[model samples]
Target: MIKQTQKINFGKRSGLEVYPVSMGAMRFPEMDKAIPLIRQAIDAGMVYIDTSRGYGDSEIKLGKALKDGYREKVILSTKCSPWVFKAEDTDDSSADCTYKRILESMRRLDVEYLDFYQVWNINSPENYEKATCKGGMVDGIRRAVDEGLVGHIGFTTHDEPENISRYIDEADWCEVILLTYNIFNQKYKDVVAKAHEKGIGTIIMNPACGGMLAENSPVIADAVKSAVGISDAVEAGHRYLKSDPNVDTIICGITKPEDIESTIANFKKPAFDAAQISAIEKAMNKLSPDNAKVCTSCKYCMPCPAGIDIPAMMDVVFHDKVLKVPGIAKEKYDWLTGENNKNASKKPSECTACKECEAKCTQNIPIAAEMAYLARREEQSWK
Candidate 1:
C-alpha cells in the first residue's frame, strides 16, 4: 500500500512544495468545457499545474481560470516554444534565444515570477546548444532568477534516453526535468534515477501513455500476476516512479474529476509486488519490439453511441500504429461511414457534440470532438 502522498520536496535550492500529482493543462480549453474540473483538481490538493505555449490557448485559459487567489495557492510552470529562442524569425534551428523567451513567457503568464520556466521541447543536441550555449538559454534563465522574474530554470525533452542522460550529466544547472514516461513508454528508466540522485527533481510527463492504457483495464489486470507483482495497477505505474525516490512528482494530464479521484486513490495505497511488476514486463514483451500496441485493450469504455466499437478501434489502431502508414484501419473507417454511401453507417461526421461517449471512455478520449474534426476533414477524396 502507498505509505504516503505522492508529492516530494524539490531542491534547486528552490523552495517549491507541490502535490506529488500535477495537472498538465495541455488540453486546457478543449477540456475547459467545464471550469469546475480545474477547480476540482486544485481542491483535491493538486498544487502543480504545468502548461506550455505550444498548447494553444491552454495557458491563457489556465491564467483566466486560476483567478480568485488560485494563483497564490499553486505552483505554476509553463514553457516557451523553442521558436522563441531562435534568433531568426524564419529559421528554427536547435540553438535557443532562451534569454529573451523567458521574458516573454513572463509577460504572457502575467506573472512577476514563475516557479519554473522551461525551454519547451528541448529534446535534441541542437536544442541543447540553444539552451546551454555560453550566451544561450541558460544565461537568460539565470538572469531571470537574478531579476526575480523566474524562480528556477527547467527543461523538457523527448530525446532518446541514452543521449538525454548524457545531456543531464553535463548540464548541472538544470533544476527540474520533464520527459515522456509511463508503463508503455519507459524510455528514461535509468536517467530518471540518475537525475534524482543528482538532486534534480524528476517531473514525469505522459504518465497515461496517451490514453492507451486506460482502454485495456481488464487486460491490465489480467496481465498482472497476483503474487510478487507491484501493488494496484495505477499504483503499479506510480510505484515504478515512486520507488526511485528521485522522482519529485508525476505530471499527469487529467481532464475530469474522476481521473483525479482514480489517481489519488492509487496514491493512497501505492504498492508493487515483484510478481505484479514481472507480469507487466511479460505483457510488454508480448507487445513485442514490432507490431506492438501498448494499450491494455480493456473495454472499460463501452456503448459508444456511434456504434464505433472502441475496442475494435484500438485493435486496428494497434496494428496500424505506424502513423506514416495509410492503413486498412483508415480504409475501414471510411467504409463504415462518410457522405458517400458505404455501410449506411455514421462517418466521423455523424458525431454530435453531446460528449456522452467521453464520460464513459475509460481513457476519456474526447470522441465527439475528434469525430467532428475527422468528419470535417474529408475533402481529400477518400474514394
Candidate 2:
C-alpha cells in the first residue's frame, strides 16, 4: 500500500481537539507537581492524556487534574498488560486480577470510558502467542471495547525496527501505535509508514530519548535552536519528530510545569528545515555514545516474572559495557534485581520457562533469555 500522506489537517480525535503535542505523566513530579503540569499541557490545547495503571500514581494524579469537566476536553488513554489473557482461564487473569487496577484508574481519573485503551508494551520476543493467542491479552482489549469501557483500541511497543514491523502487521486491529520512535531509531519508519497506510494513529515516546538529548547535545541542540527558534535542547528533539507528517502526537514525560511550557512553546516554533534534520541527527550521534542503544534505564519492560527490572538490568549491562553511567548502574543492579525485594516478591532468579512478559514487548527483545543471562552473571560475580 502506498503510504498515506493525508496529513492531520485537524488537531482532534475521538471527540477531543488538541495541539499536536500530548502530555505523558509517567515520572515523578515533585511535591504536588503532577497536576499543575498536566493542567498546563491541557491548557496549551493538548487534548490527549496518556497514563497507565502501572505508572506510579499517574492515573490518579491525572484524575485529580482532569476533574471539574476537565475530562470533557481530551482523549484519555491507558494500557492493560497482555499477560492476563486465556480462554478457559477466563475466571482469572493478570488483567482481571488487576481489573481493579483499571477500575481504580478510571475512578481516580473520573472517566466512564477511555478514548483509547492500549496494550502497554509489546516488546517481548514471544510476540503474538502471548498477546493474540486464544488466551492472550489482546482478547481482553477486544472484550474491554465490547464492554464499552473504552472507545478505541491501540497499543505501544518498544521493539526493534524489524520486529516492530512484524508486530504492527500482526496487530492490524490496533488503532494507535505508541512507539519509542525517533530520528535516532531508523527501524520504526517502515512500521510507521504501514500505520499511516492503515489510518491508525501514531504516538511517539522518548522523543527526547530519556532526557539524554538535552543541552549536552550541543550540535543537534544548536541546529534545533536555529531551526525552531527554541533555546532548550529537549524542545529541539520534540520539533524534529513533529515535522514528520505521519506522527499524530508526541507523548512527552513531563516532570515539571516548566517542561510543559518548554514543550508547548516548541510546538509554536517553526517546522524543521533540511539543515535541521541533518544537524539534529549529527548532534545526537556526536553527543550520544557510539551505541546509544545501550540501556536507557527506561523501565518500559517491567513486571518481570523473575523479578528482573529489564530496563534497569539492561542499564547495568549497558553502563558497565556501554555508556558507563558510573557506579549507579552497579548500585541499581544490586538494589533492583537483588535480594532487596526477595522477601516481598520473587526476584530475577525466579524466571519460569513460561516467558509471558517476553511476548508483549514492543522492542521485540529477548527478555526471558536476557534475565537468564543476568542471573547467571550474578552468581558468577558473587553479588
Candidate 3:
C-alpha cells in the first residue's frame, strides 16, 4: 500500500494543504474503472481532484466516484469556459448565467461547494478582458464565492508566458493558476516563480507534453540517466516538475489503476538535487542544431488542404532522426498510415507543398519541406 507523505501548504493564500501530485479527471475511464482509481488516489494521499466542464462526462464520472464518503477527503476543482458559452450565445458570462452553470456542475458532482473554481482557457488578452469585464464570468464566480457556493477563484491558461505573468499581476483575486509546463518546454519557468513569490498556487498541467516526453527517446533517456541514474523518461519528466519548489502540484491525467500506482510511486521517489537537474538541463541543451527545429506537437499548423497530419508526421521525423529512436517512429508512422485505420488522413507522401500549413505554424517550421523529407524517408527506409 502506498503511504501518504507529509503534506505541504498549497499556497500561502489558499489555506489548503495538499499532496504534491494530484489527480486530473480529464481522462477518467468508465465508471467501474474510475471509481477504484479515484478511491485509490485519495486513499494514497492524492487528495486534490480537478475536472472541467469541457471534459466530456468527466464531472459526472467523478461525482459518482466521490460517493460513499469519498467527497470529504479531497480539494475538488472544476472549470467553466466563458468563451465557449459566448460562442453559443451572449449573456452567458452574466452573473446569473455563470452561477447557474456552477450550480449545475455541483449538482453533477454531487457537491455542496467547490474548493476551487477556474475560468477556463483564458488564453489571450481579449479572453482576459472578457472574463474580467463587468458581469463577466469572473464576476459570476465571485458572486458564487460570496454566497459560499465556491471557495477560491482562479484561471487556467494556454497563453504565452508574458500574458500569463500579466494576468497573474492583474488578477489579484486569483489564488491559483494552472498552466502547461514540462521538461521539453520550460517557457513558463519565470512565470511559475513569479506566481509562487506572490503567494499564488501554481498547478502544472501536461507535465509530459501531452505524452510526447513519455515516449521512448534515447536522447532524453541518456540525459536523465546521466543526471539522476534513472532512465524512465516519464518518471524523469515528472521528477523535473516536482523539483521546482515554485510548482505547488502536478495534475496527472489518470485513466487506469496502474497509472495511479505509477504516479504515486514516482512521487515517493526522491527528486533530483540542483546539481543533477543542472546536468540534465545542460545535456538536453547540447543537442544538435536540429534540436531548435524540432516540432513541439502543439498542432498550431494543422488542417492541411491535402488532409495530411503535419504534426504527427513531424513527430515521426523528430523521433526517428533527432532522438535516434527509429523503431518508435516507425510504429507511429505505420499506425498513422495503416489501411485498417479509418481515421487515417493523407500520408506524408500525399502533401502537395501548398505551404498553407507553414503560414499558420507558430514555430515557423518549414512544413512542406519537412513533409517532403518525411515522404522520402518513408520510401527509402520505412517500407
lDDT of 1 at 293: 34
Q: Give the TM-score of candidate 1.
A: 0.69
Tens digits of lDDT, candidate 3, 1-383? 77568788787879888888888888888888888888888898889888987788899888988889999989999988766433235436566777878988999898999999999889899989888999888899999999999999888898999999899889988999999887767778999999999888889898876665666777778877887788897888888887889988889889876777787788777888998788766666655334556777777777778988888888788767787667677878888889957678588888888898888887888888888887887888854
Which tens-of-lDDT digit does each residue in 1-383 have in candidate 1? Answer: 21225456775445566667778887653534536667678778777888876666676666666778777877888876544433246434322355566665666667667888777777778778867777666776787778787777778888888888888789777888888777667668788888877778788886655554554445454444343254345556665555446567888676666777877666665445555556565665555434353334566655667666555444434433422123444565565555644333545555556677667665655556555545544544422
Error of 1 at 136 (Å): 1.5
Candidate 1 residue spans exceeding 4 A from truth: 1-6, 11-13, 30-34, 83-99, 217-221, 225-236, 290-383
Model with the higher TM-score, candidate 2 or 3: 3
Top lDDT model: 3
- Encode model 2's per-residue lDDT on 1-383: one tens digit a residue: 11112225322333233457777868847537767667767767666778887676777788788877788877788875634232233434344533444565678677898887776677775754566667456666666677888787777887777787777677666777788777556457677777766667778887776565552544444645654466676666777777777777788777766667667667666768877777666655543433464444445556766555566666556544444333444555677744634434344567775666557555556766666766676677733
**How should the candidates be ordered by TM-score, best one leading?**
3, 1, 2
Each prediction's total of clashing residue pairs, residues at least 3 apart in sequence or on different chains, is 25, 18, 0
Q: Could you estimate the TM-score for every candidate?
A: 0.69, 0.68, 0.82
Q: Candidate 3: lDDT of 291?
A: 55
Give the residue spans of candidate 3 off by over 4 A: 84-91, 287-316, 319-321, 324-350, 353-369, 372-383
| Top TM-score model | 3
